[model samples]
Target: MNLLDVRKRSLGVSFNTEGQADIYVWSPIAKKVALVLPDKNKTISLAKEDMGYWHTSTTDIKPGDLYKIVLDDDLERPDPASLAQPEGVHGPSQAIDVNTFKWTDSNWNNIPLEDYILYELHTGTFTPEGTFASMEQKLDYLKELGVNAIEIMPVAQFPGSRNWGYDGVLPFATQNSYGGAEGLQHLVDACHQKGIAVILDVVYNHMGPEGNYLNDFGPYFTDKYNTPWGPALNFDDAGCDGVRKYFTENLLMWFRDFHIDAVRMDAVHAIKDFSATHILREMKMCVNELMQQTGRTHYMIVELDLNDTRFINPLEEQGFGMDAQWVDEFHHALRVTAGGDRNGYYSDFTGLQHLAKAYTDAYVYDGQYSPHRDKIFGIKAENNPGKQFIVFSQNHDQVGNRMLGERTSQLSSFEMQKLMAGAVMVSPFLPMLFMGEEYSEPNPFLYFVSHTDPELAEAVRKGRKAEFAAFHAQGEAPDPMAEDTFNESKLQWELLNQDPHQTMFRYYQTLIRLRKELPALRQLNRKQVEVVPNEEQQTLVLHRWHDNDHVVCVMNFSKTAQQVSLPSYSDSLTKVLDSAAPEWKGPAASPDQADSTSAVTVQPESIIIYTNHA
Candidate 1:
């Protein structure tokens, strides 16, 4: 059966042809199930059907009506497939007709994954209002910034307003605080109109601790394995079909109903499934079917720490057909090269050499022994295309998980921040910019949450403390439950009008424009790229070519200026951009031109770009 037909026949609330509410739920353990309408003070018993399913249709209920499911006339809970939770996670699920939204993106075909310049943002802290409406107001700003795609953090309904969004409980319900279901549709439709694609982050490995009633309905979790968050989802257990179907429906709901162009699955490595057909492969097959049926393109990107290329490999080769994945190795190596502390995971990376490896090969630990992991970790991704990996210098986890939550702007000098931006933009892999990285926003992206349960809140605080025990000498971690922590993480939008921030913003704009327009940089063919690392001088040179077009990027990570030899590919190379030039307020300007015969003096902690055509 098709995904829509399957959803309508066996899940929460779907309207029938006669305009009545058709309710279905899966509960093998419930001897009796009834629909309870608290507002109307009414009860309707559902008839038990095959395969642990219950069914009932009612003319009294309509869209916007709040209702709950009562199991065996005892425990009451929200619908597992709820489209809207107007109240909080603990409240009743509201019936929402997703087709009501008037979409204006009929001609909006999605951009190719190769052309994507993604900007990752947390909806809650991207703006002061922290709602879908507020986010829509900044589409023009993002468009001007040259990012064709925006990857929003998870919006699934959590316990309260303030959260990093990983604590989401209801996978189908939109966060009521963020304007709920209709609000998200409006934002997505607006984004499409501006020639931008929206990618939503989703978590399926584990549900949140509070208000998670999936176990009360059926065997949605398994004791066979555990996740850091909580009990692992029952993807391979006896009743695994119901659990798999539940998430498969959620995946389709975002693309089919909400019109999301892509989904960035959060932490697929944490999902434990020993089944012959892995859950990720199953989901990819379903997505392929949906894409064929709709005649539109959609993608599934994953946040995976495992350097396994099997996840992104083609399904015909007995692998999961994921379009792309975030590569954290690039971030670690780049940070260490920029003089970051060599502690924790940073200890595994040895500065310039590892960074150069990440440029050529997608994984720094590809089939190599890892001292930090105490064993050989990660298979080689040598055969994977460059577009299959996304690289970034700073992201939410890289910043927020720290004790101080210090951003690259807070840790490095102005020159170093610009160098990091150039490093990411010049790589062969797809590049992503965190919320305020373009303008060098000084505020920290700290971890924050607002759970109604005090014990759970305290537990989160203690967990943060324990996670950062290595940095105990720095200071006590901020209280995650405090409102101030969330407020402090908000992006300082006004900083763009200031000094170095304005210069940094212009630098990023130019870099993105160059990446889009330059033939050598725009092409993502890894075979045409060469990275030469000079460990002695703490510098690296990246050379890229497409057809006859050639460009070179030289990055100096040292504390002093270094004389670097130019490549012999072209007789004369013209300077395109200099991060150390007077326009960007650097210490001093470097030579504007260089050839194979003459060495160029590169400024300390800066990047200079040269092109053959110029």
Candidate 2:
């Protein structure tokens, strides 16, 4: 069946072409189901349909009406497929007609995945106001920064106002504090109008702990497997059909209703399904069909710990046809190269060589034995196109998961930050930037939440403390339940006007412009790139070519200056960019030219780029 048919057959309140509302809910176990309107003091009994579905059609209940579903005359709870949780997770769900909003993106076909320069931001911490409307004001700035897409963190309804959005319980509803359904639609419409695509982060492996009422209606989770959060969603177990349909319809809702260009599926490694046809494969097939019908490009980018090529392989090859995935190995290797502590997963990477491997091959471990994992991990993804892997030096998990939530700006020198940026920008893979990384926002991105239950809140606090036990020297992990922690994570926009921050911002803009304009940099072909690593000198040389255009980047991770021989792509090669240039506030004694005839002394912790055609 098509996506619209699936959404109609599944649970949730949907409107017909005539503006008539029809409510369909899956509750095989419940003997009776009734739609309860709390404000109207009315309860309407729903007729039971085939395959354990409860259905009702009504003109009396219109958009903006508050509602709850009662099963077997029990306590009233929000709908499992609520479109808007306007009054928090525990309160009644508000009915929303998605078609009411006027969209102006009729001519906006999404850009290709390879052309995407993604900027990921958390809604609560990106700005002081922390609303969707507030984010719309920053579209001009993002467009100026050369980012074609923005990936918003999860917005599903969770308990209270403050959260990282992973604790969301209502998968279908937009966060009420973020201006609900209308606000998100307006933001998306504005984004499309500005020629920027929107990618929404979504979690489907496991639901959050509190305010999760899916179990009360049906068996949405399974006892067969356990995820890092809790019990895994029932994808391959008994009564899995409803569970799969619910999530599939949720995907369609975001693409069709909200106009999201892509979805970054959170932690696909934690998703366990041993069925013949995996859940991911099924969802991709549905998405493929949807794309054919709509004539718009939509992508599924997964966050996976496993270095498996099967996820991104073609469907005809008996693999899940996902468009792309986030490669944490690239970040880990890049972080270690930039002098990050050798703790946790950072232990597996050994600076320059691993970073070089990440440039040529997407996965650094590529069938090698990892000391941190204590086993042989990952297969080679050398054949995969660079566009399939998204690389970033700093992301939410990399920065926030730290004990003090130290960003690269906090740990590394200014020169090192520029070096890292050049390394990522020069690579063949798609690059992403964190919210405030452009100007190096110094504020820590700490983990924070605002759960109503005191016991659950305390458990979250204790869990955060216990997570950092491996890094023994800390006084205490920041209290995740504290309002101050959330406040501290907000970006300092004023930093862009400051001295070094302004220089860094301009440097990033230049790099992005080069990445977009340079033919060698714009092409994301893995076969066209070559990496030469010097472990002795702690330096990496990357060479990329597209037809007659050639670009070479020299990166030095060492604390001391190093003499490097320049690659002779052509005699007419010109030095395009240098981190040590006087305008970048670098050391006075820096190499002025990169000539193939003689070795040049590169400044410590810096990068220089040379191109034949620029």
Q: Give one digit per residue, the lDDT tens place, for model 2 in 1-614.
A: 11235233246787777878889888878999999988898887899887678898887677889999999998688999999987799999988888778988999999989999999999999999999999999999999999999999999999999999999999999999988989999999999999999999999988888899999888899999888898999998988777888898899889878889999999998888888999999999888877777887899999999999999898998889889999999999998888888887899989888898899889998899999999999998866788999999999999998889888899888999999988888889999999999898899999999999999999999898888877668678999999999999999998898989999999999999999999999999899888888988998889899999888888889999999877765455677889988889988444545557877677899988888865
Candidate 1 accuracy as lDDT: 0.91
State residue 488's C-alpha deviation in candidate 2, in Å. Answer: 0.3
Kindly list the per-residue Cα lDDT of model 1 for residues 1-614, writing each as its tens digit. 12334233347887766778888888988999998889999888899887778888888788888999999989999988888888788899998778778998989999999999999999999999999999999999999999999999999999999998998889989999999989999999999999999999999988988889998999999999989987899999988887888898889889988899999999999999889999999999888888888887899999998999889999999889999999999999999999998998999999999999999998999888999999999998878988899999999999998888899999999999999999999999899999999999999999899999989988889998998887778888999999999999999899999988999999999999989988899999999988889999999999999998889999999999999988886458989999999899898887777887888999999999998887
Model 2 residue runs over 4 Å out of place are: 1-10, 470-472, 589-593
Clashes of each: 0, 0
RMSD score of candidate 1 (Å): 1.4
Assess each prediction's global lDDT (C-alpha) against the native.
0.91, 0.89
Model 2 sits at a Cα RMSD from the real structure of 1.5
